[model samples]
Target: MAFGIAGTVAGSADAAEPRLMAALGNTVLTMTDIGPKHTQVSVNDKPVFEDKESDMLSFVGAYSLKDRWIALFQADTGAKDCPTRFRILEVGGPQPLVSYPFGSCSDAAQVTIDNDVLTISMPQPGGGGEAAWTYRNGKIGRTK
Candidate 1:
């Protein structure tokens, strides 16, 4: 269905407040920046997961017909060797079912999961080039 966290959940401005939240069908993913390096992700108004990260410069997410979620973000920190990190989190579970790391993260902005194949286009830490992965046999494996 509709993706992206541009829309603020209405009737919630007076509530605790949400920095950004995206909806896919009946499931909702809410993110609140706890600090410069910490973020909390919640579903159905209940906080479920918390992650430590560098300053997030960009974030995007998408959902599949099975209600599985894929969240991608670029984490830029104050380091030369490890300046950024591309973090991916799979949602709709008690915890992340699948996780992947790319480069210091992706300098580009494209992440998609069609069916069970996940194609990610991002540079590696030392120039490894774009990579691909697929979710089959209940595991995530690099394809390219």
Candidate 2:
């Protein structure tokens, strides 16, 4: 497998454009959602992810970066736009995957994919930082 760092991000997050569309080879995954609050994500036509009862706002975002299917699950931490947790998923995946380590909820953050690396950053949160993850050998490893 050829490894290269991807430098592009493709997705839509506008309030008016509350839909997600991504393609992995020929299998296209389309997500429709009501977001930034109680987001319910439906993939390909059926519901696959939802978070309720936590009183924490949840959101779902999808992207096609480096030919990989990436989905982001974000939960707010009571701050206006600050998120407490970000769960990144490589959809339509090769299983037995690596589990990401998320520290205690500290700040608001967003998710990004770069060169096969998935990063969740909470720059807006005062003491909260960020982490980067890479998928290789069927394992998810933190690179930074």
Candidate 3:
């Protein structure tokens, strides 16, 4: 996937609508207005993923796979114990490839990607260690 112009997604063309979060090729990711102060992830003008009862969407990160783009997002409810959802989505796909009920919203800061491995440092109640997943050749799986 190529970003091509790159700036158009974050440029003035999308200034009139919801803020475009990221883009690669024709697949555009945006945080769209859902209701009063609520937003969700929209891909190619379609609402693809939204946290249940979540009021805010936080972009964790995005990675460029060999053939596609994978992104991580958090839907936060602003509660201390509420499990912040860690959503992984393939750009332009129908839905999230995986959604893990991770730790608190603050844990979203621990998510990262290296090469093709996506890792999350889990706090207590999340198995108390690091969980990893791998994306390669258009496939996703738990990294062994």
- On TM-score, the candidate that comes out on top is 1
RMSD of 3: 7.7
| 28-101: candidate 3 lDDT, tens digit per residue | 78876556546667776667665546766677778775556777767766666764656677764544454554
Clash counts for all predictions: 4, 4, 0
Work out the TM-score per prediction.
0.65, 0.47, 0.61
Q: What lDDT would candidate 2 get against the real structure?
A: 0.49
Q: Which stretches of candidate 1 lie over 4 Å from their true place?
A: 1-16, 65-67, 92-100, 112-114, 125-128, 135-138
TM-score of 2: 0.47
Tens digits of lDDT, candidate 1, 6-122: 565865433334688887456776877766677776766667555675666356656462656666656676567677655565666555543544543446645666676666655
At residue 43, what lDDT does model 1 achieve? 68
Model 1 collision count = 4
Better of 1 and 3 by TM-score: 1
lDDT of 3: 0.59
Clashes of 3: 0
Write the residue-wise lDDT of candidate 2 on 43-130 in tens digits: 4444555555234533455566665566555556555443366555565654312135342454444566667666555443454455
